[model samples]
Target: MKTLLFCMLGLGLTACGSSPKNAHSNQDELAMLVGTYTNGSSKGIYTFRFNQETGTAVPLSSAALPNPSYLVPSENGKFVYAVSEMNNSTAALSSFSFDKETGELRLLNTVPTLGADPCYVATNGREVLTANYSGGTMSVFPLQKDGTLAPADTLFQGEATGPDTIRQATPHIHCTVFSPDRKYIFATDFSADRILRFVVHPNNPIPQTSPEAVDIEADSGPRHLTFSPDGKFAYLITELSGKVIAFSYNDGRLKQIQTITADTVAARGSADIHLSPDGKYLYASNRLKEDGIAIFAVNPENGTLAKVGYQPTGIHPRNFNITPNGKYLLAACRDSNVIQVYKRNEVTGLLEDTHQDIVVDMPVCIQFGNYSARTKDTKN
Candidate 1:
């Protein structure tokens, strides 16, 4: 019955009268793991189960850790990597072996990030990368074959600073992400106002850091980045200036092409950026003063963005994710301790609140994966 409803919806027949509960019947159970700051009622990381067909979710299980502020699962889904967002002279990245079926996690190992206040983590199935905010460096850890993280392999430290007196007094590496093709890595430095590019060398332990860095507008604190599905374009969100910049990506380099403000009335605390799976739209979050998501329509021809609209959200939307099926958007409101779920309109690229909020204290990151209800042992 759910399969038939899904087929009808795919055929553009809304009159088929399919209910939300049956929307995801054709797909496997959608599992989401949320990372949160530990200062509130939250302990560490929490898991939630959802029906993609119904666009709804409920909390499942949680594991205790210290300041698990950022998380990224391995490419094969066998492991989850998280960063201890601390600033007591040093920070660490912890590894966990994930059990997809039961939504459980076991601690594998933890290694010093060789820096202070590590904020972001990314991997290419072999190496784990982290961005240290206070230390102004990027830490690299090699992932062992058995889901553990090796000791620090390298630390790429930045020496530059931007024009902002208070915020840009020193370097602050905000995010570390890889190109979809896995050929390059991009690290955004907020205080330096630059995005450093590196060529991925799977054979060598460390990446070959490029000498040329992409410099954004002087005071724009480049925070996070997302690449278009086609890999021809990339979008960057600046935290200090509340702006989004569109760039042309090719051969391990970025060239800025366009710039736009995320919100004129909001404080400059732009946090995260992600593109729709279909590559038709881009979404960015605004924090601090105005809590909302600013939407933009992607121009397929020129890799540019046009402001479409904005949806107000809970306080401090630190991170968010668009469902793989492109039917929903989930925003993790850090300050409000709730995850706001919204239904996505594919045709217009707009969002409408579903009013299905998953309450978890100080939620900072949200990621989606698939799990098997039958076997509970399905890999990835």
Candidate 2:
């Protein structure tokens, strides 16, 4: 009779073994690793603690750094590089040490941008690249071991020579980014309507000058550029012309393949462009047409794009980021002072508003970092 009772208990345990609690536990772990951003005052930087799961954010601390507009994390996630959009002739890039555990930022050092009103920055390995919008130049800086930025090593002044007085009066280097292979540095010049590419040397702090830069169509005003995950194609968004151009990239060369209007309506423009991690979707932000995001589906075989409709964001979505897991998107609506959240549909390449927003003053950027395994194991 005791053996019979034991056999019955084992059968019961095998019949109902699924655990809903374990599924919920995994979801909770996902939310803890999301990062958050806050606006530094016109002359400062703000920090925040991010709850990755529920899209909740809270201010952590603030540091005074003049006109901080853009932030780029170091390769190791230990430092954040920012640009001060100062009109002063000596505007610079500032560095901060980031506490991954606390989401706090401590001022590290500043490096001269060698240009005025430096607006955007990007990090490649141990070097920092900056684009000065007002000064029409690009600069490269070395990153020190302790999360500080060394002085600028290379400065390239953009030149504009055209008849279009309104748009091409002078050079405006708007954005700087590196290729996926880290072999080339690409800088988008708005006033010059060109995408300049430089060959990067492993030991050099600055990219070596290359004669391979590609000039886009006149008055297109290329603002931001990104490559597909496979690096087979490149996409560029123009701020002035409201166009999204696709190019075939082969062996570090770009050849224009197609151009489509980013504007759903007749005359609107875009601010930024980003590719989905899976390389199936492309997104561009429209600022003039009442704050909307344009979605495009990429054709893998030909590297072309098809319209995937648009979604309305908050007012003036200056910059946005897709979470690492590709589950959510956060848009930094600069004017509304809110970072709006959206759930992304992987199958359809569409976004649905989550109705959850993080309020901060003049927030302009959003980024993500993965939590360490030890922290995850302990359930932080």
Candidate 3:
């Protein structure tokens, strides 16, 4: 996979250009884009105007589609890619051209994943990757010159079983991630209890996989992953066991260093993990049981986690995001159909609910667009 900004630079496209003196300043207020499951009253993808200083959100616009469960925006915020998490014949990936000033999403194109329920999608700015959860495969799509993704040209499948017979009967790739340096790819193969690694081939669609980075705990069902700002650390949240595993990462090599449970990891549904922008705190979201956010303090001397606090959230907190300035945290509570906003206390590494909920239908993914993101890897 590759970068859209860099890709545009390579193709000599000027749409990626910025204003006066060629500067892209992150405005105080930016567009908040949410992806939702259409099983209920949800319309698909929605947008909001988010104020970074006040920690408040106001509804802006919405896009109608099927289950656009996960979304990944381009580095320049000019485009977004989302997964249509559906079955066999209907499952696909859609690309949208985003208007940063207006926060409007115009459909660019759609491509079949060839696999069912691609719950996760990732890109390195060159190619797009999808982790087909139901079909148990990893599919690849090259990026077109105009920002639309090319047709699915390659598919990766692994056959293995973990300790859990019911959930791990076959390979279930949940998330695909690129190394911080963007040289390699790492995938959380949930059913296999292993993190798969692949070497980037620049323009190649066929994956050249290396040895899996690390094997997860038996039946852990690793779901999502996040890296520290320095890229020296990586954190993974396991859905089945609801545990958070910390790792020391280098050159695409990840070493498991610590593992901690947030009261309930055994089938409680640990969904997403993220770190504060300052790299002081790490937060993990859980579902099915307490349905809250687990806050932990990160050790700077050595990458590890110590449980600090927990903030209860709405019904099924699927995916969440911390503001780039690290002033607030937002949780996409899917079942409750609302996005919960919480203020973060930097000193104690804790969260306080502000009672600010952006009501929507089954909001599963929350991402900030139309803003100059702090320089970091494109994490989803």
- The candidate that wins on TM-score is 1
- TM-score of every candidate relative to the true structure: 0.90, 0.85, 0.89
Sorted by TM-score, highest first, which candidate order results?
1, 3, 2
Looking at candidate 1, the ten consecutive residues that score lowest on lDDT are 1-10
Q: What value of lDDT does candidate 2 attain over all alpha carbons?
A: 0.72
lDDT of 1 by residue, 184-253 (tens): 8899978888898888886985888544588888889899999999999999999989999999988787
The candidate, 2 or 3, that scores higher on lDDT is: 3
For residue 5, model 1's alpha carbon misses the true position, in angstroms, by 29
* 367 Cα displacement, candidate 3 (Å): 0.6
> Ten-residue segment with the worst summed lDDT in candidate 3?
1-10
Candidate 3 or 2, higher TM-score: 3
Which number leads on lDDT? 1
lDDT tens digits, residue span 1-380, model 2? 00000012311211122222233443332211112232332225655444455544444445566667777766556677888777786587888776655556787787778898787888875788889988899888887767678888888888786346876798889888888787888888788778888888898776776535788888788888889989889999988788899999876688999998886664445787888889888888888566878899999999999998898998887788776666777787887766788888988889988776665557676665444232332111
Cα error of candidate 2 at position 316, Å: 1.2
- Which portions of model 1 show Cα errors greater than 4 Å? 1-28, 371-380
Per-residue lDDT tens digits for candidate 3, residues 29-58, read 667788999987667887766777666655
For model 1 the local lDDT of residue 107 reads 95
Which pairs of residues have clashing backbones in candidate 3? 2-124, 2-125, 2-126, 2-127, 3-124, 3-125, 3-126, 241-265
